[model samples]
Target: MTEYSAFKVELTEHVVHVQIDRPEKANAMDAAFWSEIVDIFQWIDDTDAIRAVVISGAGKHFSAGIDLALLASVASQLGQDVGRNARQLRRTILRMQASFNAVDQCRKPVLAAIHGQCIGGAIDLVAACDMRYCSSDAQFSIKEIDMGMAADVGTLQRLPRIVGDGVLRELAYTGRRVQADEALRIGLVNRVYADPEALLVEVLDIARQIAAKSPIAVAGTKAMLSYMRDHRIDDGLDYIATWNAAMLQSEDLRIAMAAHLGKQRPTFRD
Candidate 1:
C-alpha cells in the first residue's frame, strides 16, 4: 500500500505487484527513483502481507536506464578537487547499488516482466530478481560502455553468474542490444511472451503460485539459495542445516501435511 512517485505497489492475494510508473519518461531512473527504490525494497523485506513480488513497467518501455538529467546533475556536483569528486562519486555509486541489493536481499521471491526496451539500469534491476520474463519484442542492453563508462550498479557483479562468464563479458564489452529470443537462448530471461500484457499475466500467475506456498518455507528457501549462490556446497549445506534447526519448528509443515491428507488447499498466514 506504499505510494511512490516512481513506483506503484499493489498487495493482492499475497503477491505484491510493483510497477515502475514513469512511462512518460520511459521509466528512467532519476535521483528520486534511486532513493525511492531503496525504500520500496526495504519495505518489501519488512512487509508480512507480501509473499511474492512481480515487477514491471507501466507502459511500452521497461526503462531507458539512468536519466541523463541525473547524470548531468552528478557531473555538475563534481567540484574542483578531483580526489574529493572521485570519493563523492564512489559513495553515490554505492548508494545507488544498494537499491538493487535490497531487492536481492528481500525474503520474498521477485519476478520481473519486461517489455519494449530494458537497458542499462533496467538490466541491473532485473538481474536482481529471482526470475525474469519478457515480451517477444523486448530489447535489452548494457549501454554504459557505449557511454564511455562501466556499469556501476549490480549488473557487472551479478549478471555474470546469471548468464555465465563468456556471455556476460561480451555483453559488457560490446554494449549491444539483446532481443527477446536471444535473451531466452542466452538464459537472460526465463520466457518471452507474445506481448507485454501477456507477459504481465503469466508473470503474476507464477508469482501467485509462489505466494500459495508456506511463507516460512518460502523465505527460508530464498535465503538459503541466495546464500548458496556465493558459497561452497558444503558451506551451503552447513548453513541450511543450521538454519532449518530453528526454522523446522514452524507450524507450516503440520498444516501442509494435514491439507495434503485431507485433499484440500492450505491457506498460509502472512
Candidate 2:
C-alpha cells in the first residue's frame, strides 16, 4: 500500500507484482532504487498475506544498470586517504549488495519477469530470484569488468552456481551480451516468451501455482534450499530433518490430505 518512487507495487490475491517505474531512464538504479529495493523486500519478508512475488520493468527494458550520475557522485566522495577511501568504498559496496540480498533472503519465492536488456545491476537483481523467465528479445551482460570493476553484488557470488564456472567467467570477462536463447541454454532463465506481455502471463501463472501451495511447506522448502546452498550435504540433511520435524504439523497438511481424498483443491490460510 505504500508509495515508492522507483517502483510500482501491486498486490492481487496473494502475489505481489513489482515493476521498476522509471521507463524514461531505462529503469536505471539511482539513489532511490538502491535504497528502496532494500526497504521493499524487507517489507515483503514481514508481510504474511503475501505468498509469491513477480518483478519486471515498467517499459521496454528491464534496466540499464546503475546510473552514471550516481557513480560520478560516489567517485567524488572518494578522497586521497588510502585507508579511509578503501573503508568507505567497502561500506558503499555492502549497501548496494544489501539491495539485492533482500530478494535472496526473502522467505517467499521470488520470480523475475525480464524483457529487453537486463544489464549489470539488473543481472544482480534477477540472480537472487528463485526463478527467471524472459522475453525472446531479452539480453543479459556482466558489464562491470568493462566499467573497470568486478561485479561486487549478488551476480558474482550467485551466478556461478546458476551457470557454470566457464560460462560465468566467460561472460564476466567478455562483457558481451547473451541473447535469450543462449541465456536459456546456459540455465540463466527457465523459459523465454515471445515478448514482455507474454513473459508476464507465464511468470504470473507460475507465481499463482506457488501461491496456491501450503505456505509453511513453501517457506520451509525455500529456507532449507537456501541454507543447503551454503552448507555441506550432511549439515543440510540434519537441518531439514529438524525443520520438518516441527513444521510438518501444520493444519495445511491435514487440509491437503483431505482435499486429496475428497478430489478437491486445498485452500490455505495465510
Candidate 3:
C-alpha cells in the first residue's frame, strides 16, 4: 500500500508485489532506493495480510546496479578523508547490505521476478530472496570487479550457496555477463519466461502456491533451512526438534487433520 519514489508496493490475495520504478536509470539503486527497499520489507514483516512478496522492476531492466552518481559520490568522499571516510563508507555499505539481508530474514517468502539486466546491487537483492524467476532477456553480472572493488554486499556470501563455489568465483572474478540461459544452466534462476510479463505471471502463480500452504509451517521451514545451512547437522536437528515442539500444536495442524478426514480444503485464520 506504500508508494516510494524508487519502488511501489501493492498487496493482493496475501501476496505483496514490490516493483522498482526507476526505468530511466535501469532501476539502479541509490542510497534512498536501498532505504526504501529496507522499509518496504519491514512493512511486509509487520503486516499479517501479506503472506509472500514478489519483486520486479517496472521497465526494461530489473536493475543495472548501483546508480553511477551514487558510486561517484562515494568515491569522491573517500578521496577527501581516507581515515574518517573509510569508517563512514563501511557504515553506509553495511546499511545497504542490511537492506538485502532484511529480505532473507523476513518471515515470509520472497520471489524475485527479474528481467533485462540484473547487475551488481541487483544481484545482491535477488541473492537475498528465497526464489528467483527471470525473463529470457535477462543478463546477470557481479560487476564489482569491473567497478574497481570487490562486491561488499550479500552476493559474495550468498551466491556461493545458490550456485557453487566454482561458479561464484568465476562470475565474481571475471565480471562477465551471464545471459538467462546460462543463468538457468547454473541454477542461478529457478525458472525463465519468454518475457517480463510472462515471468510476472509465473512468479505470481508460484507465490500463490506458497501462499496456500500453512503459514507457520512455511515460516518454520524457512527458518530451519536457514539455520541448517550454517549449523552442524546434529545442531540443526536439535534446533528443528525444538522448533517443531512448539509449532506442531498450532490450530493449522488441527485444521489439516480435519480437512484430510473430511476431504475438504483447510481454511486458515491469521
Of the two candidates 1 and 2, the one with more favorable lDDT, higher being better, is 2
> What range of 10 consecutive residues in model 2 has the weakest lDDT sum?
36-45
Candidate 1: tens digits of C-alpha lDDT, residues 229-269:
78999999999999999988888988999999999999878
**Candidate number with the higher TM-score (2 or 3):** 2
lDDT of 2 by residue, 1-270 (tens): 889999999999999999999999999989999999888898888999899999999889999999888999999998899999999999999999988988999999999999999999999999999999999999999999899999998898999899998999999999999999999999999999999999999999999999999999999999988998889999999999999899888899999999999999999999
**Cα miss at 246, model 3 (Å)?**
0.8
How do the candidates rank by lDDT, highest first?
2, 1, 3
> 133-159, model 3: which lDDT tens digit per residue?
999999999999998889988999998
Query: Each candidate: RMSD to true structure?
Result: 0.9, 0.8, 1.2
What's model 1's lDDT at 124?
Answer: 93
TM-score ranking from best candidate downward: 2, 1, 3
RMSD of 2: 0.8
- My TM-score estimates for the predictions, one after another, are 0.98, 0.98, 0.97
Best by TM-score: 2
Model 2 clashing-pair count: 0
Superposition error at 41 for model 3 (Å): 0.8
lDDT of 2: 0.94
The models' CA-based lDDT, in order, is 0.92, 0.94, 0.91
**Model 3 error, position 47 (Å):** 1.0
